[model samples]
Target chain A: MSSVYVHFFSVSLDGFGTGEGLSREEPFGHAGERLHEWIFVTRGWKEGGSGGVDDAFVQRHDMGIGAEIMGAGKFGYPGWENDPDWKGWWGPNPPFHTPTFVLTHHTRPSIEMEGGTTFHFRDTSPAEALEEARAAAGGQHIRIGGGAKTIRSFLAERLIDHMHVAVVPILLGRGERLWDGQEGLERDYAIESVSSPSGVTHLTFTRR
Target chain B: MSSVYVHFFSVSLDGFGTGEGLSREEPFGHAGERLHEWIFVTRGWKEGGSGGVDDAFVQRHDMGIGAEIMGAGKFGYPGWENDPDWKGWWGPNPPFHTPTFVLTHHTRPSIEMEGGTTFHFRDTSPAEALEEARAAAGGQHIRIGGGAKTIRSFLAERLIDHMHVAVVPILLGRGERLWDGQEGLERDYAIESVSSPSGVTHLTFTRR
Candidate 1:
């Protein structure tokens, strides 16, 4: 079976997965840009062909993934208004070129990229995203691409197989909450790996 | 004079903030509970203590402070360790004791909570900790109480004016990263604040 995974989630030193005021004009809100500065300089990003790439890579394959689940905010507004020129934040070739499932209230047609990556905008429950992800995993791991809430829902349900984090040193002092109001995730998790180079430190954990 | 304030300092959500070799026998490593996860729920902690306290307040204010900075590893350490008791997973009274700062060689912190709260820890140089904080505030903001790297240096720099945080999260994620690898605080300081609410979120950031 394809397991679910939350790989490469970057956060401020404080505990925020993303900055606030996620709108078209300013997606990450104030000080949001600084959150990923460490990761943008990572060797994996530069080599992984991820435009927004940085140096914060913990390991190339320690995370072990299979599929992808992203939120609309990570892809910008889902409306037809999302400019074609507004390529998702990942730049020309996003980080995941696999079968990417995007979570949105609205709907958009499936989008295919140069790599094996295909972004399918779905307006269904998170379970649906996992279901589709399982098929795409091809016996690998189902990855949860994020926007905080999307990853959170999976975590609350204990659907995450493991969570990989690239923590950078910076604080906006205000914005969104990562685990706020989150129904506690029962059955604790355990760390299984760690690595650090420049800019960021990477870590991995499995459900205990 | 500029005052350095540490913020919501805690272990890498993976349960190890103290570094390697932390065993179940010594969770929290040397940094332990005193190092993290006991401030969020503490008494002096306020999303906006500047608002002044009252019995009517609903949000957890005792943990509230003013400015904060943190290192990259302060949030999540995805490494395998022997300490199963080390539940670095934050539940309450996290080692923050205030709206804090997190220093990163990179990245930024962004998250605001109920009582006029905000957490911004990223790319912040220690030199900026005090000056930037004072200019951004209406009144004196408490510096986060403890976290080896965060607190020890302040003592050496003599930048901290006050300190407070609870000690309840328990020990497990341990080894040693507290007094070591850090310089000594040259100035003599006093505990200006202290409170033990239900003995859960200790109140330390208040009296001083």
Candidate 2:
């Protein structure tokens, strides 16, 4: 059965998926590259990075993932819609070798990037976007790429079937928070947490 | 050397030390002991709970602690200051077998309880309260007893030397958040995370 899940999502101990003041130069903003340092040291990140637990988790990002639904924030920095030629943070060849749906209020033409990745702009709710992505997924699972708000929206609506969040042991203090107002979310899921040697705790929640 | 630390502090995956609508009947409130279910099943919480990892962590709550600094929220329900007769949530004999300084703007006369636990109210900052608590600690380590706000206050001042947070695998969408405005706090601490068999990730942050 095809499942909708989030893989390799990193959040601070304070639960900020991304840090404050996110911009083009500082994609993760004040959090900078701190939140992702664990994965960056993994074999999946650098050419000679270690192939330990971190790498194993990083490798799952693309496994059996046929489509992706990401918020506009994850697609580009704020105000990216104004740039008519903006593709994404990723260059001509994005890592996502699948049909990717970017949820934005502003619509744009589909972009065919290098490899199998294609960016399709959609101004739809999570469910609506999931429907289109599921069709394009070809029976494979869809991944929810997030910048906190996007994932919160999906989780709030009970749309996320499985979620794997890597909790980086840091405090961002002031930033966009991942968990807010989605009270009683635990009732629907069975959650487990395991710590990796790389100093990140992976929290996996599967729908009950 | 005496160190300031929190032990066996349980929080929701969202980083809420305590949940919404806390009162006399429902201490953890809407969370309703759910966040502590893991510890409750452990021997440390029961009369004959297992002396496993969970119990070992829980037992550390009193080791080498001479005094405790707790937020007023932890002392009692909201507006507890108004009730002059209110001793605390704990009956005549509280678990804190030390001088417990309650950080509250509304100061009250000291109340001595059984088992060496004494409640002293102080209208002072985290630093000032720590100074008083340290004196009472009699050269022993100080425990920061919290309900989230108190710990955040100490973390904001960078006064806490060590912190042990037990991440319970549940989401309390609404509550007093523990990690607010302490951005980049991880820079000052060397953190390690380990998962206990009872299903809680113990995150230890020792100051660098």
Candidate 3:
């Protein structure tokens, strides 16, 4: 069975996945790259970066991922629908070399990028979107690419099979929290944590 | 110089220090003892318990602490002020063997208990309370005993010199959050994290 996984999701120590005041100029808002700065220095992101525990976890982002389901917030800025020229934050050849489904109320025609990645806009529920992504996954695992709220929605429905969240040391104070409305979420999964030398704690939750 | 510290403070993965619906029967409220079950198994809490990394952290709760300042919620249940006979949740001999200041709007006369513990109710600001506690500490380090909101207040004022927070795997969706109003708190502290074999991540933030 193909499992639904959320990989390389970074959250602040205060439980915020992304900071407030998100705009086209600041994708992470006031949070900047503090949440993801650890990954940038890892070998998984850079060629000759540190190949320690941080890299070991960041390298798992692309392992056996067939398709991705992302929220509209991640697909583009707040009013991205208004701008018809929004191809996505990623340039021509996006990183996701698979069928990426964008959950947006404003559904548009599918756009096939330079790479094997094809952006499919869908206006459906999390479960419904997962079913479509699963079909496109073709026996491989489906990745839930998030902007925080998207992952929380999937997690709220208990649709995530496995999740890896890197707890950054910074406190965003004001932002979209990842753990909101996720009360008693530990009951459904077996959780494990590992702290890295780079001062980030990697938490893995596997469905029981 | 005597430093202020928060030792063995437990927070859920969602960053909630204490659960919601606090009452006389349940001290930790809906969270019950889920946030502290890890400490119960440690040798610091019980004899013949596991003496591993978890115990090492828990044992620090009583080290070099002359006085404690806690929130009124932690001293007793809501409406506890009405009951003059209500001593405290702890028996005649409280665990704190020092002068403990309870921050409450309804100030009352000080009560002396066994084991050298004295409960002093003070309706004052965090800084003012800290000054009184410091006087009672007698050059010894003061510990910040918390229910969540109290710690956040101290943190906001940048009065805390050191803090140790145990990040439990559970999620308390509704409760008093410890990280609220503490935006960009990581800038002031040199933070480090270590994951224990008992499945708890111990985070230490030392003032830089």
Candidate 4:
């Protein structure tokens, strides 16, 4: 079955998926590369890196994903919309080889970048966006790529079937938090945790 | 050396130490026993319980500790001060066998309970209260007994030397959170994580 899920999403111990003051120069803002340091050192990232448990998890980002739903921030920096030449953060060939939907207030025409990825912009609610992405997904699973707000919206509407959150051991105290207004959300899911030797804990929430 | 630390403090994956609407009947509030089920099944808590890593960690609550600093909410329900006869939620023999300081504006006389635990009320800052607790510790160690707010205050001031936060699998979307205004709090400490088989990840932070 085609499932809607999130994988390899890294967050700080304080629940921040990303930090404040985001820009083109600092994609993760003051958080820099700290939240993703665990994945960056994995064998999937470097040729000579250790292929341990961290690498084993990082290798699942692309699994069976046929489509992706991302927020505007993930597509580009804050004001990238004004720059007509802004294709995306990914130079020519993006990481996602599937159809990607970018949720934003200002809609734009679909831009087919290099490789098999295409960026489709839309100004709609999470449910509406999911409907479009799911169709584009064919029979494969849909991955929720986030800047935190996008993920929260999907969770609020109870659309996520599975989620994997990597909790890095840093304190990015003042940023986009992932747990606000989510009281009693655990009732619908069975959550489990696994701590890696690299000092990060992976929390997996599978819908019950 | 005698250190200032926190031990066996359980929090949800969202970083909440205690839930909303804490009362005498529901000490952990809406969270109920879900946040502490990991410790309750430990050998240190009950007879014939599991004596693995979880129990090994739970048994350290009273080891090498002399005094404690807690928030008013942890001492009793919200309006506990109105009832002068209210000793505490811990009954006659409270678990704490040391001089415990309760931070509150309504100062009251010290009440010496059974098991050598004394409840002392004081309206002071974290530094001032820690100084008194350290003295009462008698050169042993001081444990930070919390209700989330007290621990946040201590963290804001960098007064803690060691901390062990158990990340339980459940999510208390609405409650007193443990991380806020603590940006870059991890810089001063070396952090590590270990996931127990009981579905709780223990996070330890030691001063660098």
Query: How well is each residue in A8-84 modelled by candidate 3, as lDDT tens digits?
Result: 89999998989888899999899999999999998899999999989999888877988999999999978999998
**Tens-digit lDDT track of model 1 for B46-123:** 453322221112134333345445443444343422332322334344544345455545444354544443555556
lDDT tens digits, residues B1-208, model 3? 8999999899999988889888998888899999989999988888999999899888877768889999998989989988888778999999888999999998889999999999999999999999999999999999998978999999989999999999999999988999899887888999999999878999999998
State the DockQ of every prediction. Answer: 0.04, 0.79, 0.90, 0.81
Clashes of each: 83, 6, 0, 0
Off by over 4 Å in 1: A23-26, A47-65, A77-87, A90-93, A182-186, A192-201, B1-208
- Residue-by-residue lDDT tens digits, candidate 2, B86-115: 999989999889999999999989999999
Ranking by lDDT: 3, 4, 2, 1
- Rank by TM-score, highest first: 3, 4, 2, 1
| TM-score per model over all chains | 0.49, 0.95, 0.98, 0.96
Q: What TM-score results for chain B when candidate 4 is compared with the true chain B?
A: 0.96
The CAPRI-style docking tier of model 2 reads medium
lDDT of residue A90 for candidate 3: 93
| Regions more than 4 Å wrong, model 3 | none
User: How displaced is residue A156 in candidate 1, in Å?
Assistant: 0.8
lDDT of model 2 at residue B110? 97
